[model samples]
Target: MHPPGADTVLVRHGDLNTKSNTVKRYMEGLLAENLEAILADRSVPGEVERRWSRPLVHTTEDAVEDATAAAADTFGVVSASPCLTTSTEKDRILEVLAETARARYDGGSFAVDARRADKSLPYDSDDLAREGGAAIWEAVADEFEPEVDLDDPDLTFGVEVREDVAFVYLEKRAGPGGLPLGAQEPVIAMVSGGIDSPVAAYEAMKRGSPIVPVYVDLGPFGGIDHEARAMETVRVLSGYAPNFDMEVYRVPGGETISVLVEEMEEGRMLSMRRFFYRAAEVLAERVDAHGIVTGEAVGQKSSQTVQNLGVTSRATRLPIHRPLLTRDKADIVEQAREIGTFTESTIDAGCNRVAPDRAETNARLEPLLAAEPDDLFERAEEAARNAKLVEP
Candidate 1:
């Protein structure tokens, strides 16, 4: 029903139907601002204009492809479709429909769905659908089959006749629906270049929290390739937020680990993890972020055991959000793949070292308390301040 090349992209609110009219309009604007921010980053030319009170972004044909893909990832967007903007005249509509059909109609079974929003039009919705379907069939029947199925067809063409202009579309792509990025609260995501952490960062982003990544440099345990991997993972996460570039804080993790090794003969792992939490808190304060996000799944690692997790929690005052706390590794792996981090996560970089023997699975708070080092929080703050900004 639409022209061959799509010039307009449709963006729908994630949960507009659940909101009141006023809230719906606000959500629409919020989605637009976020998407506009996305396009602005690319320097792509376009305007997000509403059509018939619906969010339909208008972009030049040259930029439509990039805009469509970016719009699909922006939070708060439910579905996006590339559409042709045309006049409401019947002849004009049929002419473009026929031309598009001749170019793309594969002589296959297809159906037309038409809605006349401009009630001023004489014809009803069903009449326009039947008429448009018949026109497409007549125009392309010479080269292809023209079987029309009202129920289920190989292809479904759409036409919406609004007061000012009509829109035609062939496909609708799914978007990650939630509040827009920065809508909730900002969080510092502790990324380890492993599978679970970046995925946890993604979950926070999906819930509308902008992410500031903090990568702890464990020194000789992880080499240059290890740092590169961590940066790459942050870059991967940045793809989700086109409008905002995610920053990585390369905290001097070696200092904390070295201190734990020198000061604590027992519960060193737990002490090291507590250092991680303290680093997260420092980074969050520096960036004005409200909390910390981690991919620490329960029982997944010795440091992640319930008791050990509790011991680590005491290190930070800010709220710690463990998005993958209860999620299974299989589920996390599937999500990592979905978010394009699975390949990078699987790379066996030298940074991920083997654990020492007697890895404390049930790190007790009492032991950790006894082995605590002096200037622990002060060293953590210093490490945060000395962190270098790394880019992929």
Candidate 2:
């Protein structure tokens, strides 16, 4: 078990200056509200407020561990810290700093990294570091060896002394830094019971696009296990959004497989791919989405080859956002694990069971169109109409 922590959480933003003022304000609000939801889950009493350029959440010291862990899931937060805060009187600041370092450092090697935001008062940043380091070393020297290694230390105490108050913290818990959820226009994401798609959807959500997940259910080929896995991935993703409103829609795709599987035997997989995009296009219109989101990474598979993506997307002239298009598979998997979807995405009996052995890698658009049925959009529209919303 970990020890109790300090009473406040110091939240730092990601790249906010580049965004427009409206977008920055919107993300700030969403990030704070998401943290508030996490606090409510733990029954922690806290209030989130902007200080300087970042958010500072005030909660009991005992709740810092829980809050820190929870805050790491929120997007737009570069990092968070459970910190001790006090008035910036020279002696008072140094006293609290020494006390915090004493509790955290157990002799070995340590260093004090101090920043002087208020230069008007007393000593500069370097002198403050030495003063704090000496105080902590003296307090902890009896029990363990105290070697002050300025270059690299086993323990580091970071101090930021503002005009009226100072913050002292040991570590910075990292969050997925991006635009917050709901900051961008809504997108209808095509999710699958696979590692890549879930991670792709997560990337879109991380960039502030509220996603309406559209799962293409492969009938008998995938049993209940497939649906369960997709929904579970969505549930895990919901942690990032906290309290955002979204839904998962499962559309029957067996009809599409039957049409392409028989009509275009040579380029059947490409036909299926086209249908998927067409289905998402129709769903996007229904949901009034800006565009469709897919998990396609460039050349991840034969079906995702640059030529193949062009062929597949031709049916849906509407914009298609492929967030993971240039990303490597390993990086996508790592991100899935970070967003809590990796384990669920690895569940049994997925749609990959139906993948063709010699699928087309560089399919041509004209040929794929010739192979597809004229009423392709009609059937795709039907699938979209049949889609029903479900809770994650």
Q: Across residues 280-299, which tens digit of lDDT does each residue of candidate 1 receive?
A: 88778888899999889999
Count steric clashes of candidate 1: 3
Q: Residues 1-392, candidate 2: write the lDDT tens digits.
A: 12234788888878764778886776688778877887776577788886645688887877777777777767677888888887777677678766765677766677888988887987788988888887877777776778988888877787778777778888778887887776788888887878887887888887878888988887766678888888888887776675776579888888777666566655676777677788888888888788888888889877788988877788787888899999988898898887789998887544465566667787787776777787877877898889888887
Clashing pairs in 2: none
In order, how many clashes per candidate?
Answer: 3, 0
The reply for model 2, stretches above 4 Å from the true place, is 1-5, 20-23, 348-350
After aligning candidate 2 to the native by TM-score, how far in Å is the CA of 151 from where it should be? 3.9
Candidate 1 least-lDDT 10 residues: 347-356
Error of 2 at 157 (Å): 0.3
Question: Root-mean-square deviation of each candidate, in angstroms?
Answer: 3.5, 2.2
- Model 2: what TM-score? 0.93
Predicted model with the maximum lDDT: 1
